[model samples]
Target: MRTLLVSLLSISCLHAIDHGPYIQWFQDPCHEAEIRWVDRSGFQAKEGEWSRGRGGFGYGDNDDQTVLNGMQNKYTIVSIRKKITLAAPANADDELIVEALYDDGFVLYIDGKEVLRKNSTGADAELEAPGGHEAKAWEKFSLGKIASSLKTGSIVAMQGVNDKLDSSDFSLDIRLSIKGKTSTDLITRSDSWEYLVNQIPEKDWRTSTSLPDAVPWKADAQYTLGYRPVGNGEMTWTSANSHLFARTESKVFSVSLKGLKADTRYEFSIRNESTKEISGPHLMQTAPETFRPMHFVIGGDMFHTLPLLDAMNIRCGQEAPLFAALIGDHAYTNNGNPDRWYQWIDSWVTHCRAKDGRLIPMVMGIGNHEVAGGGFFPENNTPTPDKADEFYTLFRMSSEGSRVISRYAVDFGNYLSFILLDSGHTEAISRQVPFLAQSSANRKKTPFLFAAYHRPAWGSGCKDDAVDIQQKWCPIFEKNGVDAVFEHDHHTYKRTWPLTAGKRDDANGIPYLGDGAWGVAVRNPSKAELQKRPWIAKQAPINHLIRVTLAKDGFTCDALTADGKTFDSGTYPLRK
Candidate 1:
């Protein structure tokens, strides 16, 4: 009888694990859709003329009442597009439902096919042409003949809304409420595995043109010893099913958990020993000592914004990454104050999770904003006691015997190696270069190697350069075959074609990937500014988290949006 009961519970767990398909939710016809907008200044706009600006909240129960009044200035016109895909064909009589809040007029198109034009006047002849608009809010439009429209790959529903030329305040907010069947999502961690492994289906994980080998792992081995690495200090760990308190004043501080079966999945929670307050029942996985297949998310510059922060947390849930390589600038409070730092730290630990309620663990790096004396104001070239104390206090550092918790390296068996550097925040670049060089030289033949810092050496037109990094670290990264250097703090997205000495040399060079947009909903870099850096192969002005994976075949990196889709992806071959 007991055996039968156990089998039933196991079946229930397996059934619960399949959230949906292996890829991100392509469409949810029942719920309101997500909108991507591009604003154009003049009436005469070209198809490729609009810049990709980032900042759109998803719609749900309050979607119809959603207000998008971010603009206080009266603008000329706004163009937007929403990509909707269906898993199965819709009925021929199905309709495309949309509600809008516009100042002047609007034009709508599904799959580039013109559906309706309301109040559009003056020079709006072509379907792609912009027109003058009129004031309207909560205007509903149910256009028929959209139920079975299928484009080659994906369907685009475009809308061009115009604002009154003389209006004092301008804003355009719209929602596409479609009724149809849509492709859905399946969480990666499969419960069918007796061992820990990332279960992907049909090699279609990217959901885009890029084919990145999304490696999950099979860690059937055990640590043997009970001691596991958690935070700066070591702690003995059991499984997440039980509570293990840190032997400190705060019983619930972050600590590295060691001594578990390799490639295993576990859920953990933190409890304040004194108050009995609990923080998480969050999920996590262990690193396999061998290169089975693994991926991790990395970025920085959170700046304490809730929406953007939620985006990072949301992506973590979707990707279910092994760990996040956080390269600094989380929470804009740079000034050294205990209360401010504590507030930021509290927020960071509480959020930052995967879509399936997995709490993320960060492999941290120190950015200028991470310290007390560095910011838009003056910067001290040296480290102080309070600068990165909060970070050090909140997380574990595997710095070996060194005192510099700000910089360290973690070895995931022979599979991967990471040189997490301090980038002049806690230690001057000149001082940390020797250690970086030594570490790089030793790991020259590793299958996958990465170096991370807070600032950029070859950024996209902004203060992307860190003189010390350009002269000191760049030489080492280029010479030692560092696959890529993860960087942040510029608040824009960028990827360089293999670079050597600040120039693109694709033949033999290191690609600098970042301009952290994790939680900062800052504006995208102007097109003009983006053109200034000829070395940048790709750039996105959106908040994102970067995922790099060491697959069975090669190495892959993708800039994933908050919605669990790959905005841009690149895969690299391993060195001989």
Candidate 2:
């Protein structure tokens, strides 16, 4: 079968079909790109010691294929050159397509003439100095019809510049193609995203792989995230929501698609309006207007090793749940590092798709690791939004804005509610009391009201009971009759007997589940520790996620391990 598959692929490559509405000439898919790179100080006009490697050259970020060591604190620029051998070339009507991922900035040259640049400044004849912009996402540029410059064979060169020699990280990657009329659409899972030239001028036309920065109070584009919904033969472009990342000033934005029939599947693609880059033909489903059986997976300590997280994510995807509630410690960026967030988000998008290809919506909460400096603060100083900038920015918590406050509540019609809390990560635990009290009160009639936060109030694996949570929030949870509370941060699996006022109350108390072992290394509470905590009903040392199925009168919880094996299960009646 393997041999037959290889043979079939080879045969398909031999015969090219005219896939046109627009003319396109892509680099040979099988060709290994020959890239040479060297530091600026070591560069010699055309003769210098250069190292041979593929594209993506830099260090400090995980994206690099060729790691440039010692580049930090020594030089701010690296010279990169690639030899391109086109199958055919030299057409005035053909535009040379250029896509680059660069930190600081860079200038692209073909046959020693400057064709494009970004975050860089210098004359055409000399290397451009670095600009101060950190790399956001891949930037796309269409160098219109390079017939006079590009021939059958040309040397492509770039000076990958860094914002500063002392910068923490640097990277540069380049992709080249040729297209007539316009470049090929950025193909995503569900659609072919074509670029429309008239939207922006060719020379000044630059688009990001991610959404552009949010436009302030613009009617059509109000958010940091932007999208153009492609359907039938027309495109409706709109943008909504905005949450700012303090470090890069990049906002996470969204575009809303409203007035959909309940329980119906819809397809849409995400596109950057400015750069004309598009991704997705992703799937989504609306909730039924009437009550129905549904389930959602919840977990925390979400990111550890990539393989472990991916395995668990893939399993969760297999469940085809309506959504996922990642309580906290997501990405474990630890210090709000943008690169780590990039990796984590990419992984989730890639692995968390349901078998039917639906993109699972995420409900998030703040945790200790989400904040820089380990989520601890002096008694008088409460943790603030700026401290957990990445978390607030990457995930929009409310229409008010991610930076407004970490605690918020979301309802699924009138059947279910999720109260996401800060748990001392971004806001004081005591400060959350009033908010929690009111949030729980508003959801008193909700059939399945649940609370999720990072720290545990009745922890099984750790000694500290998160006293503040017990004192300030527990009373509110019990008073308002929250059905259950999800707790994380201890890295162990736990389920507690229903407790109303710090003591188990089988009939009226709120049951607490989870010690947040998601993708992190799991811990086993010693026999002594379990014995000391009488409220504990069950415990395990395993990476698992909780799949909660909500019914009309009750919900069922199943704890599945990393490989999707059900190790524990229980059913709880909805609190009256």
Candidate 3:
């Protein structure tokens, strides 16, 4: 029987007072409330005048001041009745975040004592004040520590005390969320492995015919680790820094398998030594020298938007793939501000968890939009200065210097390999040519070789016709026997035939998929352009996502549109 899980928010369990009748709630639980004084006569604060606080609340905007008033005999708390429940975690390291909005000054008490205090009343008062108000609201506060204090079924309460002299429309909004341990919650099963191709001697593993640069062998390079539980025993394998070429250096990285029972469920994760952030405890089942049919999802260019996120969630629910490859443009950065990236990841953390409450293992690629001006031109290019900086900081991607630009690859068991490439802001494609060539040669054992980058080699929406792909990257792709290429940019869907240099379709050419319709929109591809390109096989004007299934016969690809239509479908046979 298949298990079904649904995530729901019960507001009554989150707060002590019920303010639902007076204030409107925002979709993002993290945001502060937009209080409108519904009482008509305004709020009467007798205790003291409501003033601003120091840090305000914990919301993103620091300019919003929190309401503050001292306890006085004249003050009567105009109660905004709301109840907040504390999130109890199954594990110890779990974190809970909370945000509240108020007019004037306010204090947070756990069991009737001050845990957090805010008073934005001085010259700094203007800085903490929320935008647009005679009396601004407090900034949203983040209470990771508070989450740690919660007992499973504890009552979390909040009181919005108001001063007597100050009277205006009073209201408050509250949000509570919990994040569990990052790497300790995955399901793993163990199986014994059998070698497929032993033509190359075991001692000569470094000289094998796999793509050379595809595997990084640097001693300092990061690695992914996990344990497979089989009954009463567990098997741990720290992924070897498999080099794409024999000439590449070797690196030492290992995964730990612990406390796992043989043939039992366990979890695994990728740890980046450089950043100390864990990738996942994503689920995987192991079989002894046998194949377990696997499924996964791939798509990119998701700008922060609720409707698109909702659609993606629905699609994932329907497909129920084991993993998702977010091939770049996961978030849009306007003017290359890094704060936007933080917001984007935070948004994902709040919404993108799986039905089982497991964080999906995301294989991320860099998109043009992630860079400074969202393009490849030198004028538009401004590499993020720190390697393992903001963006990479959150998702443990390898970095060269301060820039998160590096060639990386991941093997799905022994059948397929995903080569994630960076194509924005930093160095041109020419710089990574060596790595690309090495990646192609390493695919002999892995029948399926998929590559993804930011911009497309061929697309219809833009009249330029994927100039960058044509000029700089096509040769590299053709030189290496890459199977399919995933590209994002146009905010509309388009797929191309396997073609060689220029545009002639070739039976042996590599197929190109995508023009990134994840969350943004653009003008439809013109009929003239569509007709002009014979290699163009499919197109969709709506937001859509791609699902790829790998099997023994070959591979199947389907494009599912936002409205739940399968706009395109095709099968690519394995190389003979």
Candidate 4:
């Protein structure tokens, strides 16, 4: 009786484990499917199974006897057929998380390293077993790892093994999510180059193509190339002599130009391709031969408020920086629709043009709002099918169709490198921890370093509660000598005193800035909470934007509120 009860319990567990949705099967080892099966005995069935009663059941009865009276024992190998395609920006740090449910056991591999292993058994086994011999089952296992080192077009795969005696009765289910660097690297030297330029009318510019000149600039005119000499500085344009045409859908136009120097600087201007409305009286410097100073804007949690965008536009215009880094929460809610995203893009394109009419480039990191609303509890929500399919497509990144190479380093004169990380709505921080450690070594090339993400590591505001950042990401930052970290999420202004491990506020420690106040309302941090956390250097109830100016002496950071008030200013000296 005791033996029978034990067997019954085992069978019951197996049955429970097997009772979930079915994942497709795959034959290629590199495919991103969750289940795979190989049949050894040549027994064929739509689904697989064998009946114990067919051969008459008895204590310790062998189901093989029924199959082998004149036949041979059969084994069915099952595997997942679906694949996970990671969308990562070129050269950016990223991670991939794969979750699967299967019968028996599973082995996960990324670039062929076994990352996770799991086995399941029980009374439920009988219920899931083929013909009631001894069923095998497993369910829901998660595996995560950094994708930074992965090459473009690399494949990720998962394999499952079941010890069932029959060639039939196999099942599995699998899903995947990725975070970080969804945009492809646009600065690479290649022939197939597409340019998206913004042409504001009255802003003198010239173009290669002659279309019925759109909104901003007119068509067909003799545009002049303006120049001025200042000090010993040489004027150069990063992009010049490009074909220009306005984009019908978006507010920006595109220019494609070639025949220029590599790692060299030249100044050029654009006039209406047709109207000859010369748009540039300004100058841009090209990438350096080695390492040069690269500048970009960082902020997040912006709702579709035009006023906030206007402020940012004005500041950015005055600053006239290179790129913009948005730490997620782009649209109000739901990553399902493209309307909000498009609107946001249109607004930026319209207002944030350079003096020469170039639309500022954008690099985005995922946020809770970019995924399914709140990011902490992600399992309950699945990406809407169509939206999920289109999300990566709209963004110009190598995050689709088996590409690897997430997490990019923008080398600004080999002295400063900005590492953009993804911290929400996808994989957990733990997976990318190792990559963060490795990134520290880059300080040798770029002595000044910083990291940007969507969520804050430390917070004093009531809404600033992100446990994952404190636990998983903080240590990496501290260990890496990351000069500072910029984060968004909470809608107020706060800065951390160079901190180590959330508490020790050492001058050498990593400082954290932000709580995303782009367009969001501000909430003050209480005195009691502020007192408890000494790492907070300054906390205020204001909506603001941060600007960093890098020079040979040191870098200066200014936190300016929307109304152009300089709330805080600090400088980070270059490390010896």
Candidate 5:
């Protein structure tokens, strides 16, 4: 009975994982469809007319599983259909929830019946997609009491429309989930083995990725020790099942361990069931929950120049900071190429470590190059989350579940806080202001308050400031007493004299500490170029990371090169 129950539980757990496929068809501009028939059951697409891929289908957004080739200038619509074959009929009280990540407009149909419409017009065959829409995070719509409509073989179809045929990008993807009695998620952890071995020494897990089935682990765990590293690892962990949180992307999974003491260190390991391979017994420490003495590394624009980045990564690891704030421009993988990310992660996993061998937890913000169609930020246009799909998937902290809201705040036990902003990559700069204001205001009392983003509002390399950021967010930082602001993307080193209202005011100014020259080719501005920008207190064409230490009295920052040389240092007292 026990064996059968375990087997059944394992099957149930596997079935609950939601990484499935959908059939997609990008509309042809030369011969557009005059009728919409794919939404109905038994509607078979003509041979070679449709392609199958995971959710998220579209063009130019790099993250799309099914790229609508040549659709940017030729067509403005793509239709996606998924067949739901539930094992049994849904209960009358069961709730059906549909989550969608879309851009411009879309119309949803269930078994050929119109169900929901968003930013779109017309009906069935005449559906029109006028441009000028920005895709945000996942939006949820409820099909209340429509349990009977969810019968087996029913087709859930969506037509994703672009605002214009020449628009920069378009995307649409969805998930149909049911919630009700007997719909409990299978919470059981699998991959069980009898004996627990701690044989493998702590090494970078990227080698584990080479193990055919080895899943690369990110530094996102909170505390609980016993856990499975995504991709079918043994569940012979010591912690209870309740503490394990499973996150899935395609077939690979990431298990987050929760409910552990803060600022404490723990050892963990994973065993591969397929190869009988043992890996880890590695160390990870939870972020501090209270104020004492702590330090962290901060920089951005990495991976373009490999050797420089690797050097900086090694030097950063030696700092033994609590974490590294690698804001943006990672890999320069402009169009969602997996190989670019693979190399970047490999280097990070190998070199970005603490002196004591702890993998440095990374906190990041999105940048222009992260988008699929690189540097598409027009003053009036907004991009979608689909543009930077890999960034969200590659880093756990940058997103909430599968939904990536690019702006978020992380607080450390009332003493320190970081407000990470997305500088018009996945979200608009204006839209982030309210969040920036609220986050800054809430952290006013924090002993060490900092804001980090990819673009510099007042840049020395660039001709002008990010007008939107300067007009909207800089005031909030000054008003809320932010001690410092870390800015990046110019490929040069910079430190500004504390300024308020666009001028130096040492008594009431927030220091802008970076122009982001981590691993990218440094931009050397001559004295003539330097003389053009009066906001700079110090500027150099050098690659370095800022190491900051916080104490009860105040904090200090040191700019260090990859070879471990401190070229610049400053001490700042807490703002009262």
Candidate 6:
């Protein structure tokens, strides 16, 4: 079967295409990049005795460059520049099969930005300073997986391959292969429609505009711990809920812990592990074990709109709720650049200051923009589960062993359970049924139930609704006697009367609120339509965050405008 598959691929193969070993060399071994221009002369500058080009260069003990630091020569560092020009931007899903064969640690920079590394630890200077051999063999990597924005035209890529100023051997070999200057809509799923890749300008953390420093917000129960450290490092954290207080030699962080004490507070932080440099002694309080009034902010479509995110953050901070549940579109972080997501998140962490000093916890759900197909980072105008794993690496949602942290339940207290749904960005609607049914069925006497997902089952903007969700999850919600269902995606805002089987039924139907307007622009419902249609309880075209207050027997929710004024409100009565 495998042979047959290969034969079919070979038979249907249209062509084999790849471009460029484009090259140039610099001798400075940039200690720092900005304000250190050597000019683009296409030749070597003679400062002392340094040069460029390919060669079997080796140094003996005491060579000036090698011994410059005990170091011999001054040009121990050199950069190979490859100016790859694409007639058209490569497809977002397209990958340049980078072939790298080198000695010592090296750093790669695309255009001028340093994309998150490949199998590397530490910073570029350290990597460029020397000591990497694992990638010495020809190893293939993908460019799209590293860069956030890859577009048409010329791209200047450079890599600094290092050897200790006194090392015996050093070499540099790198290349990129992809469907260059061509369009290829990346497929979203095996049977789903395709979409385009995002083509915004790339951001260089070194120079990209940064927000003024605000108080940093700590990670919550569902927070993502960056990456597992490579070599010797400590992964340290503490959880009052779980009675956890320890440091591990290995730096692999986890999220969504079990056995945590309800209603207790926990303190945690992220460190360099090696440096013991800490991010926080910040605190996060767990949901209470008993029923009580709880406050939380709900919003979505936060597509890098810093001001909107800022307003929401500050507003939520002022409200100082138990947590913030963001439905989706946190940031349009494409090309596997987790930093893109973190940077936007950083904006919130810093600016979203509470009246009191406490880290606001977060509950998250992935939207279409968050995924490739759902809309956000479409490559070659395509979407793919192929690279959506990047989202998972940064967040640890409630899904225990699932790649898509789209669905799961978080207990707010004995009385309320937020059952989060994965609206088929990467996972199928059908596949989520088992989990939905299971979570809905086992309520543990928690009468107040709320549900959240990205796309609304009934919206007023685009398509007005999602049949997939209506069919797949609505029945389950109804069976479970859900108090209210929160959803976002259409960028418009609307609340439906209690709905059951797609129609408004006041007696036993589930109410649907939110068409999602957190950071994205507003698409208010047509005013005429609002009057003509009675199914919609209320509708508005504005950027607002919803606030929900839950008590033992009931709950109240209100949509608050950017400046923190209530525009829409609803109350769900006690469950029978």
What Cα-based lDDT does every candidate model obtain? 0.53, 0.64, 0.48, 0.46, 0.63, 0.52
lDDT for each residue of candidate 2 in 1-576, tens digit (9 for 90 to 100) = 433432332233112110000000011101111110011111101112333443556666655544455677866667655445555544678767787888878877677677888877763223355456665687778887774365544566666677676888887777777777544422111111111110221232122112222221111222112222224444444544444444532334444445445566655544434434344444555555556998989999977888878788778778888778888887887654655665676556556766666656677777889888875553357776777777765654543343467678766667777888888876778877878888789889988899999889899956467877888889888888898999999998999998988788888988899889888887787788788889998888889999999887899889998677998887888665
Off by over 4 Å in 5: 1-252, 397-403, 526-528
Ranking by lDDT: 2, 5, 1, 6, 3, 4
Better of 1 and 6 by TM-score: 6
Better of 1 and 4 by lDDT: 1
lDDT score, candidate 1: 0.53
What lDDT score goes with residue 330 in model 5? 85
Model 2 bad stretches (over 4 Å)? 1-77, 80-235, 240-244, 249-253, 258-260, 399-403
TM-score, candidate 6, is: 0.58
Predicted structure 4, TM vs. truth: 0.50
Off by over 4 Å in 4: 1-285, 289-295, 378-391, 398-406
- Model 1 segments beyond 4 Å from truth? 1-256, 267-282, 335-351, 376-380, 398-403, 526-531
Model 3 stretches astray by more than 4 angstroms: 1-291, 335-343, 346-358, 379-388, 400-404, 502-506
Per-candidate TM-scores read: 0.54, 0.63, 0.56, 0.50, 0.58, 0.58
Query: Candidate 3 overall Cα lDDT vs. reference?
Result: 0.48
Compared with the true structure, what per-residue lDDT tens digits does model 3 show for residues 1-576?
112222221122012111111111111111111111101001112222222121222122312112212222333232211122333343456655555555544444443334554433211112132222323432555555445565443333333433333343333334455556542211011101111110211322211222222221112334445444323345354652321111111111222232333223344444445444444443433221223555667777787575776567556545656556776666676333443443454344334445554333356666766555556654244365242233443344555665556467765445667777766445566666677778667764567788887677687656455566577677877776677888877778777777787565557787888777776654486787777778787777768788888778778788887565787987787873
Separately for all candidates shown, the number of backbone clashes (residues 3 or more apart, or on different chains) is 22, 4, 81, 75, 2, 37
Reference-based TM-score, model 1: 0.54
RMSD of 5: 20.0
Clashes of 6: 37
Give the Å shift of residue 231 in candidate 4: 22
Highest TM-score model number: 2
